[model samples]
Target: MPAPPSAAASTTNSTATLDDDEDELNDLRVAIAQLISLPQAGSEVKEKGRAALHGTVEDMRAFLDTGYRLAQAQDDRVALAQLHSKPDTSPELKTAVRAILRTSDPEEMRWFLEVGQYEVDQ
Candidate 1:
């Protein structure tokens, strides 16, 4: 192989690219944080996140039936799918669902990119 390239010639541009990527990532994080801070973002997110879950509403009722709750972001997404398909669920159940929304809540619009729990809408 040729002699090792000089640091200035080969590596000077690498840092600039890395910095661009870092800046983008940081901006995304800030936007996500803002959405999480909003009270309604959680419920709004639950809808799409529920779609990501890909389950019927009955499946949701069954999941929650045991009274045991899912603590992980993926589990909560699955739970939302099940709830979304439920037929004619009462308002009380809605209230209860909202209550449980805490921790399961994902930042809205970003499609829960963080993959963890968030604040619930009361």
Candidate 2:
């Protein structure tokens, strides 16, 4: 197996850490207590002071599709994981993701991006 999905992952908090008693977790817990005791990540979203207009869906689509082109070798596991985690984007976004998943060939997906529904505002 792939080393038991080691807690030693590339991205922060991307995987479940094995050491529940680790100093980092304790420190994080304390820090979290302090933070929650304050506001922001602790406070509810409705309590946020100021927020601006969100980015366009097109922009988000482009950002998600960055780096690799269709059929060019991409991490399906990572993509699936991300999609599975986010249960609150949009129906259209989810459709796009599902469409991408439906594509068996990555190269074909790339073509779709190049000359398909992958429309990004300039």
Candidate 3:
């Protein structure tokens, strides 16, 4: 029987996969942006560009959804660890765990990556 993956191996794989996803997402965004920057073109070309943009947007949504799931899992793991370490999981403890989970904003991540930015409440 095959052995389960080691923690180090799992982390490495996750990071590599996330990195590849980021690269693909960035490439798609760049392609769509380039299409937008071009001078006015024929209806056929414009239509194709719009289609490509829509598809890229869908791809991005997929990537973000996957990342969000992973983030939730990570949060759950941390919360579990906290529970294991302590006898009481109080309301304050639950609130702290929730705060940790909620601290990672997808919009903030995009802004940090310089993908795009809009005004965000501080």
Candidate 4:
């Protein structure tokens, strides 16, 4: 077999791994920041983003993987309910909201809240 790695080589490998981990963490931080900055991001999304920023790497990954979508969906539902309750909301918008609710798809609801609602209003 080949000779074992020297102490210097082992240290270099460890340092490289650390650098990679730091880069990943930095990327995750930037992603969370971007999510928090979104105009369409609701309170739940913002709150979760903030939490993930202050949490561990796993927390950030969890937020990006699942938490963000779930929080966005919750916020979307709340927004739809608020819009439905509003007296001045247009009939077309209300109808669109009803149709979105019927679908029960979080992604569809999120899309309606983000873009489809404006299209319907216009």
Tell me the whole-model lDDT of each prediction, alpha carbons only. Answer: 0.45, 0.40, 0.50, 0.91
TM-score of each: 0.32, 0.27, 0.36, 0.87
Top of the candidates by TM-score: 4
What clash count does candidate 4 reach?
0
Native-structure RMSD, model 3: 22.1
Q: In candidate 2, which residue pairs get closer than 3 Å at backbone N, Cα or C atoms, i.e. clash?
A: 70-106, 70-110, 71-106, 71-107
Error of 3 at 64 (Å): 22
On the 0 to 100 scale, the lDDT of residue 87 in model 3 is 62
Candidate order, lDDT descending: 4, 3, 1, 2
Clash pairs (backbone) in predicted model 1: 57-82, 57-85, 57-86, 60-82
Candidate 2, position 99, lDDT: 74
Off by over 4 Å in 3: 1-5, 56-122
Against the correct fold, how does model 4 do in TM-score?
A: 0.87
lDDT of 1 at 61: 38
Give lDDT tens digits, candidate 3, residues 1-122.
99999999999999999999888777876655554355423233344445555675675454344533344344444434454356665655555445544656534332322322112111
For model 4, name the residue pairs that clash.
none
Poorest lDDT segment (10 consecutive residues) of candidate 4: 113-122
Which segments of model 4 are wrong by more than 4 Å? Answer: 119-122
The whole-model C-alpha lDDT of candidate 2 against the native structure comes to: 0.40
> What CA RMSD would candidate 1 show?
15.1
The TM-score that candidate 2 achieves is 0.27
Strongest candidate by lDDT: 4
> How much does candidate 3 score in TM-score?
0.36
